[model samples]
Target: MWIFRNKSFKSAYISIIISTLIFASLYALSNFNKIGLSFYDSTSSSLPTKPKIQEKSEWLTNFVDPLIGIKNGEVFPGPCLPFGVVKVGIDTNDAGYTVDEAVTGISRM
Candidate 1:
């Protein structure tokens, strides 16, 4: 088809097709309950569970420093860190991962 054959618009065309496929799959899964999430969760109305109330770890809660979770000096805090990957560049071949979104999709010069 001419839409898919346009060389200059290959990237945009491919991205749209991929996005459409992903959206269709998600919609089907949500409707059919093929995935782990049961579709009935939405159709059947249920009372919400009482949220847990926590009092401890107030210091950790108030801390906004993103780097607070990362330790550069002294003994290693822990093997598995609770750090956020602020930026990630995508590779087209990500084990068939259909989602190809940019962490910082748009940037200004």
Candidate 2:
């Protein structure tokens, strides 16, 4: 009651209570499965299913591979993981862009 006499302290106390309630509600919703509560309706005709892995691989190999090489030897033409910081590939023009020969050593960019 003494703390609530100050406007700032009263507001801070109310905000803390509200924030705690919100966090608890969110935690309960996320752990609904463990609490024997199903968010998904069993009466629904179709159950959710994961997409085929092969289709994703094929799409990336076919579509992404060709588009990656469009930078005209400046970009590396080697296998690179998604969001990779370092890229390892052959340098086609180590001497300069004028020379059309592959460099012997691998370059990381």
Candidate 3:
């Protein structure tokens, strides 16, 4: 409040703040190389450094059926964790598939 009470003092205060910020930014940019910050390293080895992807076992889903409710079943079936609340499945109808209605395509719920 005191700084803004006088017009001259307010302009001088804002000018000082702006000049300080500019100086700080310029100083950081000028010393960027001395700071030892490297965006890319040309000396890195040519050996593959990519992370290994963990492959899921095919035997685990061998017995699981995702199309259980596509014909006559009354439930949307998909992979779900044990005791987990979230479930992913195809949402056909609110009451599920019946013998009369033909299922079109898979849809997410």
- lDDT of all predictions: 0.51, 0.69, 0.67
Over 1-104, each residue of candidate 1 has an lDDT whose tens digit, in order, gives 56556675898888899999999998887777555666346655584678987767755656664334323323322233245234232333432213333333
Which runs in model 2 stand beyond 4 Å of their true positions? 1-4, 55-109
| Per-prediction TM-score | 0.26, 0.43, 0.33
- List runs of model 1 lying over 4 Å from the truth: 3-6, 34-109
> Can you tell me which runs of candidate 3 are displaced by over 4 Å?
1-3, 39-109
Clashing pairs in 1: none
Q: Give the per-residue lDDT of model 2 (tens digit) for 49-98.
A: 77856866567556545435434656545677777677776655444322
Which consecutive 10 residues in model 1 have the weakest lDDT in total? 72-81
Candidate 1 vs candidate 3: the lDDT winner is 3
In candidate 2, position 64 carries an lDDT of: 48
- The residue pairs found clashing in candidate 2 are none
The superposed Cα distance between candidate 2 and the true structure at residue 5, in angstroms, equals: 2.9
Instruction: Tell me how far the alpha carbon of residue 104 in candidate 1 is from the true structure, in angstroms, after superposition.
Output: 62
Residue range 1-109, candidate 3, lDDT tens digits = 4546789988988999999999999998888878898555768786468797656764567778766665655554566566645556544455674545556666444
